[model samples]
Target: MTEIYYVEDDGDIGEAVKEYFESRTFKVTLYRTAEAAKESLRKQLPDLVLLDWNLPDEEGSLLCQWIRSRWKELPLMFLTVRNDTKDIVKGFQNGADDYVEKPFELEVLYSRICALLRRAGNPSGQKVISCGTLTINKEKMMVFCDGQEVSVSRLEYQLLLILMEHKGITVTRQSLLELIWDQNGNFVNDNTLTVAMRRLRQKLNQPSCIKTIRSFGYRMEDEI
Candidate 1:
């Protein structure tokens, strides 16, 4: 499902837009404040973001810039009542892919969402994955870091590739097993995964990108 985060201070308007998008079969999460939205970001990165120009806790343009710098591939759209050309330009300059002025028809908003998804190459149910210095060829088991060939073991490549594809989001150990081993329940322990991760990091030589989230699973930083 296409997951989207709607960050707006207006409760009523946010709720209404959330309902409208949910009715159209899109997974939408609404936040009343920038603080709340920022908290949600610690858990997972959504496919798209609907940002208001004026947020209570923080300006939407600031948040958009942060997302843009960290997650270079995620799509951000400004949906606000601010309709001035300056505001629109500011939003785009902050790295918004699309902008919609407020008092907009629901149809127009939906059309804009579709267009962003299409432009992101996600309309065909394909994942938009950028990993490490290299983009993983999911169809072909290949690895290219910094535009150079990097040889890795099969297990190491699979584990690193999965983490890279799900960068900015945490992946549980169970999920990792299913993705790499295609098994539901296994006797694998953290040590095994740690070995694989260490080897993968050694091959890539970028350890800061792969982060350990305390007691939780692993998450690749957005800056990567």
Candidate 2:
């Protein structure tokens, strides 16, 4: 589920692109102004961005610079009517991974997007998984709750990743052990998993978005 933030002022173009992207299995978030996109970026970092020049609220180049400064690995592309050589050059200089002119073919745009993501080594981009106040950044393997970093052991982090990746689903105890310890070549007894889970809960501010299933496994949900 590759998440894309598309900032465009034109209603027609924005909706058309959103529909096309969704049909291709991409989760698209449309922003009519650069300010709106900026605000969303503060909370959720998408895998990529489709920007339009001459945005209603701000210059798209400024937005590109802003995103690049904060998230160097985030893929960015400009889809705009600004086809002049100067504009395209400026776009790349401002941190655009790719750029496409207006009246572009949707298929070609999609291809370019795929290429950008492939170059970044994210063929199947992941959505920024969030549960309640907790956020998981898979690329960095970092977790944050209430805007503060939640430090955890390697095994705990792996456990959190699996649960957050499958939010709302009960992942069984055996599966957790297999995936977290066995698969990682750090085999441990079942009791160790219980201890780690408890420490993780305490460290993440207790009742930290993880719920136990008594005889089953654990699930991540909005309610703690």
Candidate 3:
């Protein structure tokens, strides 16, 4: 599961955001002040951080700078009421991956958070997904298992990447069919998915990372 640190002084707003994100399966830690957030961050780093422009203890901009100074690659987003152009620019300058004004919709925030996480996972202009010993390099169009190249067909590779990208999450059969059908530009039937999965498992040497959920779909587990 992905973890998020949200720093906001407003209790109502903080709980609302935390509640909404938690319902989506994301573990969120809500901090009432910048000082409290800093204390918690020192112990455990989250996948992403959501900061408000104004805080009771310290300026959120300064805290953002503090976080970037340490975890330069960590994704940071600003969810605040500061909608001024200058404030927006300052947030970006302070190393925020995204900035969304207050009075926002949850759906938009969720999409932006997903986008930032995707970028954070695959950096340096290369698209890659890693689950345990298996690696899928989308940029170079290659797949490697246990440091050795694995030969996979186009449909097989596409199917593997989709599952790997959503690491630790179950990808339903219907969703897989739709994705592969559209991306591969070929009609994919239900049996095709089952056969491809079996072949993929064998080629990967029956890796335990990919789990078969009976009567549902498959989930890629990153923990080997």
In model 3, how large is the Cα lDDT of residue 195? 95
For each of the candidates, give the backbone clash count.
0, 0, 0
The full ranking of all candidates by TM-score, starting with the best, is: 1, 2, 3
lDDT of each: 0.75, 0.83, 0.83
On residues 1-224, what C-alpha lDDT tens digit does candidate 1 reach at each position?
A: 88889998888888888899999898889987877776665445677889998987788999888767755556889999899899899999989999998888888999999899889865212343444344454445666554455788878877877788787799987678777766323454668887888888788777566787767778887441
Clashing pairs in 3: none
Q: Per-candidate TM vs. native?
A: 0.66, 0.62, 0.55
Cα lDDT tens digits, model 3, 1-224, are 78888999999988988899999999889998988887665444577899998998898999998877755556899999999999999999998989999999998999999999998883312354566667665767887776568999898999898998787789999999999999978899999999999999899999888998888899987542
Q: Which stretches of candidate 1 lie over 4 Å from their true place?
A: 123-155, 161-195, 201-224
What's the distance in Å from true for residue 175, model 1?
11
Native-to-model Cα distance after best TM-score fit, residue 187 in candidate 1, in Å: 18
Q: Pick the candidate with the highest TM-score.
A: 1
Please give the lDDT score for candidate 2: 0.83
Looking at model 3, which ten-residue stretch has the lowest summed lDDT? 122-131
The TM-score of predicted model 3 comes to 0.55
